[model samples]
Target: MSGANIERREIFRAIGELAYVVAKSDRGLTPAERQVFFQIAQEELDYDSWAAQSRFELLDEVIQPSIDRAYNDALHELRKYSAYLTEDIKEKVMTVLQRVAVCCEGLSANETFVLDRVRKDLQSLG
Candidate 1:
């Protein structure tokens, strides 16, 4: 979670925020979705920080306070790092989001819209 990958970790943090946005968009996040969300997030954010099969209660601790505000802030944070981001990083971020969006009951309309915005945000960077 340090050294050369610091920026990548920051991007992952933003992606985690976006994931919270999507999960909360429906007003009800299933236990199954939360599990998958953490899995995908850990994989993209920094797999090295956790064990290969790590799972704990703290994994369910991401709180999405103001959906719109947090979502916009996360997107803005990613966009702010556009110049520092590599193509590979952006792809991984999107992949983490998309992978979780498909878990649970699949992407709801709100989730899809938010995800589309995230995709556009990443794509518009370069």
Candidate 2:
């Protein structure tokens, strides 16, 4: 794949993993909660193509082993590209993280873990 395609794949994969982390944070993935994750993944990451399918597939493959590890890894990947993102994109990332925190009806333990890692990762971008 081209360099840009590789980067896009990485970003989309991270978003998908984030979605999974949020959806599974409550220990169960409800349809409504899944929808929230899907919407954020699509709209925020701009993965509105067939590539989204591949990205999600990768996330499904990697996220199950350990949610916290996947989220932290994804956060590190996102931080690497922070300088290339616009202010709007950065805000969208934050929005998605917040949405994930509440995807399980409320802040569950897993969601809190993800949120804390996300907050620390984003803060380190400065």
Candidate 3:
């Protein structure tokens, strides 16, 4: 694939994984959380939500990674594509994560912690 396409895929993949991580942080991925995740992804990322949704499905169905593993994997992708992580992109990323965290119910402490770490990691990219 072309470099641009590869980067896009990687970034969206990370977004999907992050959505999984946040949703699964407390009480597992609830039906409401899943719905909100896709909705926010489509609303926030537009066409790119396809890649994110694919990754989210993969984690939810196939891999079922641990929370730490999911977070680390997404972090790795973000760092790998660090050049593409402009401020606007980071804002969108956090928006999706934050929205998902509060979607099904109030945000859990685990979600709060995960979001904080994600925010810090993304901020550190600059």
TM-scores across all candidates?
0.76, 0.67, 0.96
Global lDDT scores for all candidate models: 0.67, 0.63, 0.91
Candidate 1 backbone collisions, by pair: none
Tens digits of lDDT, candidate 1, 52-113 = 11212222354436778767777777777666678887777678778777787777888789
- Candidate 3 per-residue lDDT, tens place, 1-126, comes to 799888978998999999899999999998778888889999999989999999998999899999899999999999999998888888988999999998877889999999999999998988
Please give the TM-score that candidate 1 achieves against the real structure: 0.76
State the lDDT of candidate 2 residue by residue for 35-94, as single tens digits.
566665666556432354355455665535466776777777777666554556556666
> Which candidate should be chosen as best, given lDDT against the real structure?
3
Off by over 4 Å in 3: none
| Alpha-carbon RMSD, candidate 3 | 1.0
* Residue 39 shift from truth in candidate 3, angstroms: 1.1
Candidate order, TM-score descending: 3, 1, 2
